[model samples]
Target: MCGRADDHFGPLGWQVLNGLFGYQGWELESMRDEVRPTDPIRFVRRTGAGFEAPFGRWGLVPPRMTLDEARKFATFNARIESLHEKPMFRAAFQAQRCVIPIAGFWEWPTSAGVKTKVRITRKDSKPLLVAGLWNCSQTPDGPLESCTIVTRPPTPDLIDVHDRMPALLLSRDIDAWLDAPPIRAREVALASWQPRILQVTPA
Candidate 1:
């Protein structure tokens, strides 16, 4: 499971978004090097008019789950295999799918009690638009919006780094992955998702 991400794309992040989603506006800046759960991260959402980049919390906090309750349990990464079965993600999986634009992500490759941190990025060094699910919850203060990255079993090349990786979508598949009916969206993404080899070990 991925718990941290790096979105230091700076001005280039908008360019990537424009290229992928044809979004013409900008309301976000470069995020911190490590964006953790509950942090406001930039993501793309489809509106009735079109798509736009907006800031959303990195954890999935459904309308029924209080922020306090969600914080106690891990709701950052939704496993693809159990998306429909997971109580925390089922509704969002069906109606609130989104795309998280990221530079790359970090994972703790563990063996026994020992752990090593590694930064994973595509060999091409291009930004990755990761698949995710989002939801909005009403709170006393206001409405709280959050999202979760979708994960699938890792390909053989990435199994050593982690057993699961963020479900990835390519440029051509982004439309269908977002516009298709919820179940079809999942199927489309799973069918077209490509596993990339990452080699950005950062100090």
Candidate 2:
């Protein structure tokens, strides 16, 4: 269901605007195809409004992997329930959390090989927070950056299209995940009462 996301939009996807968000080994100047800050059109979700920090394309390559090895697996998805145990994601899962504010995302239903894309947006029409993990891994050239979105089991409405859905944090629950102690992070991620039961609108 969930696949590559085109987050290009306005007013909703900025974490830090007019600046670059770099971590320990993130190569600010040497990224493969870095986007300029002046570009009026780019994908972002406003964190506190007015801040836009462009991100590298989604998909993560753990630093431990070699060039050939990384190609085998790395995409825009991660299972929220197994993050702490998945070899490729555990380290970043514990250390590098991020917020992927979305206008919405796409899911596709495929029969044999043909696919039909469906847009899934929030019923309330507000941006949704998708939990993420980021990493800057060592490559032959140097360190390269990548990220992955966390996912949970699909809700009933979404099950028809895909077996799983991205791990989404409700507007009321964003702070709870980001600020919660480690012991509570897992619990918060799996909360049923928060009800991520979003009303889906066809795009």
Candidate 3:
């Protein structure tokens, strides 16, 4: 999330994201996207060729209706099994895919009025690249960005608490998902969550 994350780094969050691969804030001034305090932070994809900045919101708002309609689908997650066909998300699946990196996520379970939250992380506790999709829209207010994290069938360990989990990508798939003009659904899954293993600890 551009503006909605805990990993923010003052005015240089953009620098950190773009330079994450190697530069380490080396290309700080090149990115033109402004930081906003919201979900889905925008950043530049610095490739061997150059940099391309895209504006995608943290939540996806598919095309088809008025500005009022967008609010109905500002969801943070999309079920992976149905991404290719879901009316609200299909367009982005083929055209505007993205990558979201996270150290982990929190899940809450409730039973008999008791609620507990557990934090899940990789065995190594490293960051994961969560696959996502996004879109840019124009309203009377000008342009706005949004996105949705794709979710796959939950691991057996997590299924009891939730039926779905974000479709996470391996580092090897980073180039394809974030840079491909169009990514195949099946291929996306293979490059993404198939081998991911995670652990959940009580929060």
Candidate maximizing TM-score: 1
The sequence of per-residue lDDT tens digits that candidate 2 reaches over residues 1-203 is 25644443333223322222222222222322212211111223334533333454466777677646766775567888788888888887676666565556776677688777677766655555676666767778876666677788876677667888777776566555655664466566666324445655444
| Candidate 2: segments with Cα more than 4 A from true spot | 12-54, 110-115, 192-203
Give the Cα lDDT of each candidate: 0.80, 0.57, 0.60
Task: Compute each candidate's TM-score over C-alphas.
Answer: 0.89, 0.68, 0.70
Q: Distance (Å) between predicted and true CA of 132, model 2?
A: 0.9
Better of 1 and 3 by TM-score: 1
* Prediction 3 TM-score vs. true: 0.70
lDDT tens digits, residue span 90-197, model 3: 887776677665556666767688888676667764555677777778778888777667777765667765666767777677677666654454466544665337
Residue 154, model 3: lDDT of 69
Ranking by lDDT: 1, 3, 2
Clashes of each: 0, 11, 7
Better of 1 and 2 by lDDT: 1
**Model 1, range 1-203, lDDT digits (tens) per residue?**
78999887656665876777776454355457898888898778898867876678888897688999999888888888888878899888777888888888999887787888889877766678788888888999998878889988776668888878888888787877777887788786566656554664844
Tell me the RMSD of model 2 versus the true structure: 7.4
- Lowest lDDT sum, 10 consecutive residues, model 3, at 1-10
- Clashing residue pairs in candidate 1 are none
